[model samples]
Target: MSPHDQHETPGIDLARLRPWFAEAVPQARAEALSATLITGGKSNLTYRLSDGGSSWILRRPPLGHVLATAHDMGREYAVMAALADLHAVDPDAVGLGGFGRPQSFLTRQVARWRKQLAASYTRDLPDAVTLHAALEERATAADAASRPGIVHGDFRLDNVLVDGDDRLRAVIDWEMATVGDPVTDLALMLLYTRLARLVGPEIAPTPPTSSARRRSSPGTRPAAAATSATWASTWASRPSSSPRSSRASTSATWADRPSAPASTASVAERSTWTWATVSSPKGGGQWVGPGQDRVLALIEEVGLSTFKTYVDGKSIYLRGGKRQTFAGAVPPMKPSALADFQRLAVKLEEMASTVPLDAPWSAPRAVEWDSTTFGQWLDANAATDEAKWLFTLAFTVIQGEDPHLSSLLLILFHIAGCGGIEHMISTTGGSQESRVVGGTQRISQEPAKRLGKRVVLSSPVTEIRRQDRGVLVKSERVTVRCKRVIVAMSPADAGRIRFTPHLPVRRATLQRRWHNGTESKLFAVYDKPFWRDAGFSGSAMTDLPVARFVVDNSPPDGSVGILLTFMGTAGSGPGLTWSDAVLDDPRARRDALLADLTKLFGPKAAHPVRHLEQDWAREPWISGRVSTRPPGLMTQYTDAVSRPVGRIHWAGTETATVYDGYLEGAVRAGERVAKEVGAAL
Candidate 1:
């Protein structure tokens, strides 16, 4: 095939590799070397090269057409090499004991990420790609750097690991690592922390409680103070390079981090909470979803150039299939929509500058600010009463209350710059349909296998009985005794646990008040993508009574058409609906949904061969899909939401700082708590 026609880059062969490794590190460990590819990375290729026992990961640029800013394997290797030794005496980053200037680190990463996304657009998610292309243009990068230090370009929990004692085991996948601004590493970590919270613990195997990252976090702990005894002796011997440019070694560090509880939980409380084993619904008859023209038209009509200003009316953003936060920024103002969006940016930046993520509620700006909800915040800033659609689509709509209350911090963190923020993170955001080739099991099975543990399915946790020593986690199939436990499931499901000492007043309040917004996804499968032929991008968003967000999740080859759509918000929307009563009659539900889709995509949308239904609220272990904050609740209890109590640490997308209701939040929460738990342990 012509190279231009090729979608992916050619895979490297061992015949070409043996010589390269021999030349790169002649001291050699290549006796009968073999290479196996690693899966799950978004834009690069990774392989595990092993000679009998030990394994080292090898990474390269993406196989298909790649953007100039997309990958730099040399930079990654240089960072790791600077940290680790040449099999002799080298200094490792984990050995440094602490980090320096994290705020500056975050600002730089955003700038770099924006650059990468501007030039690259993949085939699967054209809609998100287009919005992002425009979003990047309006961004104003944070200018908070002190001095340059070693920066790990893509510093995330998944890329790093820890030992049993919670020390940095290795900072792998250095392809993106570079020395310029070390603080960017911390910034990226914080950004990842925010994004991961949307998806539960974003990192796998690595607990959210790891100490290495905690040190990197700005407010959590002090950095560059603690010194590992062996630092000077080993690092002094290395060839000279800039402190920020040259890498540090990884083999030895002080190992001075704190420890966790000693005794494990009781045997009885260690039973199974059957969450990971919900079986897939069976049916030769297809489960239909939706083809989203409403959302796409919203994006196209709004035009990313000034979507944030509310000039084009409504804006729709989608990855291959997931929805990030959607809506307007400031309410409409007289001076011009573009000017208002720019003003909105200034307001958010002020909030970001003034309101600390750690104590947003107590921040003087919020304390003295007279706004109760986001609607009020907008109105105070000049949005009219009828311009309530921004809050209506983004946050929940509560009855009796005008302008719907919401957490100001949540708004600042999520929708502050709108397209500007999206442009910064879009490279990693999106459906990533190409990577999901592994399916759901990829999240748990792969991690379990690497850690030498088996994924025991079927059994669900019935109760978590707290003991003097630890907690007992029990399920119908098995019981586990552990010193500490990370409740990684949704708050709703976690509340079901029977805590022996019971949760604290704040935690109990959070458990009592937190509720998942009711959401339903239905798919209409057809023989072809009928809408695509009609100049449609298959994405849509609306104020329609029932279904709102819509998109097309068709196969790459287009064997069959898939139109995915969403409906139902807690305490809102038409209840004339498809909850359980129509479970038996899929057609009835399909027809009802089709009426709405037909309105957006013409009468053709009403005809589908089959329908697919996914009730995220009813998922076995996870009781809900999206965490919805109604008016006044989120800000009141935000503090106690993710904090650890004794040996029990809490995580879930709800606990994340950014995109709290998305998959990214989940990953972030998991990684953060994993580090916390790891260090304590």
Candidate 2:
């Protein structure tokens, strides 16, 4: 019977499947076919397809959203069903000699899973990174000790089919099947049995053990029990229901399965793609230790604060008015004026919504947004002074530039499209929710410690030149040659490097044009968190010239009080006039900050014990904190930002497609370049 004559299956396009199935298995020539949905895991949709005399299994990605890498039917097909009798067949003898690259298989597996995990990143998972690093470090040794063979990636009791006589019939669900260490297959099988016991029989039902000691299972195997235990704990917090690519939310209950335990569900809904069974090359061993390394694991490991952000303490100060609820200046101004401001804010956001966030850079809509400045848009749309001042303050505080200089598209992308005012202000679990116990200096310091002498401290690279099969990097004190180099710096810093061949005209021009925002950080320390007693969150926004943005920077214990102030050096922001003089003179800067703090949080703010200041613009090598694309720049040559140039690859926050100019973006960029370089090698 034709596919059109058959009842439609939710996932199967029967019309396409029938012909393809017929071609792949020509012996199954029965005219009629039927497919029944198989009850199973949420990762892939499986169906039992049948002709009158024969039945076959068909699997594909989940219905609504599919992560491309997670469900590869081609990968499963490559191993073939005939090889499922792993105990009886030899792969090389069966014309499967070129099935997979077995060299350094363990090392490659570590890198492959790390890259995959990066793809599905929702938030920070330090355990994932640490686990990856540990695995990678041991992979080389592990590979050398192991013998390569056709490995069944996920060998378990459930995955194997048995005849009525209780003899081995066939193994199934070979999506992760590949040529690698045979021990990995045996290990994963044992690990599953262990998981069944540890997580409880209800969630992970298992068959009776071969041993007479019923309590003893594969988990008790001494060979790698310690490693397996660690791996199990790592996975216990990970959601196994979803594929590597699927952005499975915690709220999404798995279909045809019991709900995951609260301990696992509460930790993270999304899987970190740590199957550790992928087949790919170990991303090359060229090491250039540039610096060091967030979310929950970071907070615990680094001893961070969990202070609740107080909305009452977060006040917005207006000229000649008392500080009030940060509700867009409602208390200080008339209701009608505040109402106009609120209306205009919503109107502007709605206008920005017209332009899609993911529109191509070359699209007319994107071009229009990129070309128009926030100031220009305000002049046309914003009706009242209240609207103009509030919008401008929010934009300048968040973006580190005045509305006149920043692109409307940049604002829309970072502000309206991103999350709106709440995100910018750092509400609970927002960007500014917590601070590392120590300064972020520890981020670079920890990695530098690991790298030891490999990290050439104070040695700045001045030039880079392409050589035979590699590139030459020259620093002030040392020079090195490597196969490829990831220049993990902002465009401005990258532009300072003298390339021997001179980068492409567009690339060079882009680097030169990519300027940094004049943002500076200031910290005022005191005896105790006095503002908390005063019903203040120690967070404030003002039109003050010295400090445009303020937040509580106290330690987790609250033993000492601190107020972090963000000031801009130039443009139409409030800090434009006072930033220069204050940044130059230490005393004047502290005095100015205290004056503003006092005005915002009362007299107690004036008597700080210590002051700390960091003007990013004045910092060496790192000219600024973040790269800011100006009007017309992002659209003009943004293509060259991430596009590789021969052996030279780029990995910076700016090159990231998501959360660009942030730490998260930087990590994502590093993972992307690692994969690119690995493939190239």
Candidate 3:
């Protein structure tokens, strides 16, 4: 065959391989070399090179398509070179300190498959999403419990070269080799044995038959038993094929395929409570959480209530220091003031709607939006001070910051395309509509109950030190070591903890600059929903300095009446401010709050059986309620806020992409970080 005219091996260049091989192996010389493609290997291509006198094997990535991290020729070569010293090899003794990042290697492997699966998604198949999710959930603990070693990513009969006597010869196909839990290699080997039963013995190798081989295999029964039903279903779900080529090929098998669903759907799709579609982020999916609200689905799977049932079309707002009862979110404004506010709201909404939730902070439109503050936008658009005050009252409570100091991009994120604040609250089912059945506290307590003794109480972590293999977390009562740590508090609170090696300058700056909004909640409990009896929804938005907004926190049965007050000090210029004297004294604060309630609800609001106040600023662990960003801060370090610094990951309401200052944002951030840490584990 002419080297130029006829090419048998698809990826191998005959003309180039001959001279290159001669140079690589200088002792071996040949005028012409013949190459033949080797079959059986699925991921990286293998070829047999013969110069008549000597033969050698050559491997390369498969032709047409390649999965990320699945094919690394250099990594394959490194593993082979490192294993050459196995007879007397000590990874540290050989100066291979940076050989591979062993920390969270198994978790990374699981996450790698998840991302690759999402990238190569075609159509949904049974057990694909479920199996992948289960693996991710368990990956962290699995990595923590295991020892790290060079993992042969794919360890099976086809990838190994054996002698005629069936004795070991050499292990090939090192493309997927990496520093990870060595048990993965054992698991995959055993899984292949299991696959033989599902795909038939012809396609997969049989289990060990010889006594020596059987004995060498580490207690086969328990390992196979531990593989679980998910592993079995993983093997039986779908055929291995390239979605891009749509060709039947075992290049990627059911045993090793990605399992994430292709579609970008959200929690609303699976929610039992009706979620308004307009309130959803741009892609109709949450900015965080598993692809289709799987994190939320897990909460439900654990038997926790996600949302509550509420009477439809019931809302109230306080305007001009008057109690105005409204069916929806239309806060009572003077006719001219309302008209002026609409014009400004429409202008800001138009600009904000252009920025999608998933758009990069550095995107052109995003950059433009961040270029100005909400105050700047209002200054240019609002015709009257009343219009500006209306904007302030609505957004300040939602965002937990003075609008002048907030990026226009931030304000737009909440109100974009949903009209302004009024439309977002009422038409979109609003943020304030639903309450968790028992209270939000149940969400945290339920998980702790399941964890039992593992969940340590009164152990507040004060320091996190990065060790060579993992992190050491020191708390008041206990110290723990982990491969990866997720800091779920606000950036401001995280600043209180000492980091041994210290954080990157950009990240440290973010923590230092992450200021909190001084916000507090006050709840008044009464015998009945008396405000409801007067044809009021028991919800009010007030311009009062002490009580900013009020909502009905009654049980579904309406057995007791509870009015929850959201109070905060806002504004840099002359706008609204919380009374410091009232906040300092409990009795004075209660008196002032009740007085405001009396003005809004009537004389019946004067007495309450119980009044509970939560001043977030006074909390030891939490210095403030929600995080607020200054005008230019987000533009400078938007990516750095959530980006992992080595083994540490950031999670909190502030780190979320959608609803960044709300409880929903906190849940989403937790979900996002859980997946992030799980992947690395």
Query: Which candidate leads in TM-score?
Result: 3
Q: In model 3, state the lDDT of residue 257.
A: 14
Q: What value does the lDDT take at residue 185 in candidate 2?
A: 71
Per-residue CA lDDT of model 1 for 537-593, tens digit only, reads 565655554455555667555678877766543343212233452333344455567
Ranking by lDDT: 3, 2, 1
lDDT of 2 by residue, 500-529 (tens): 888998899998888776777788899998
lDDT of 3 by residue, 541-601 (tens): 6677676767677787889888877666543365467667674555567789888888877
TM-score of candidate 2 against the unseen true structure: 0.53
In terms of lDDT, which candidate is strongest? Answer: 3
Can you give the lDDT of residue 417 in candidate 1? 20
> Given candidate 2, what's the lDDT at residue 19?
73
The residue pairs found clashing in candidate 3 are: 107-681, 318-541
Error of 2 at 342 (Å): 4.2
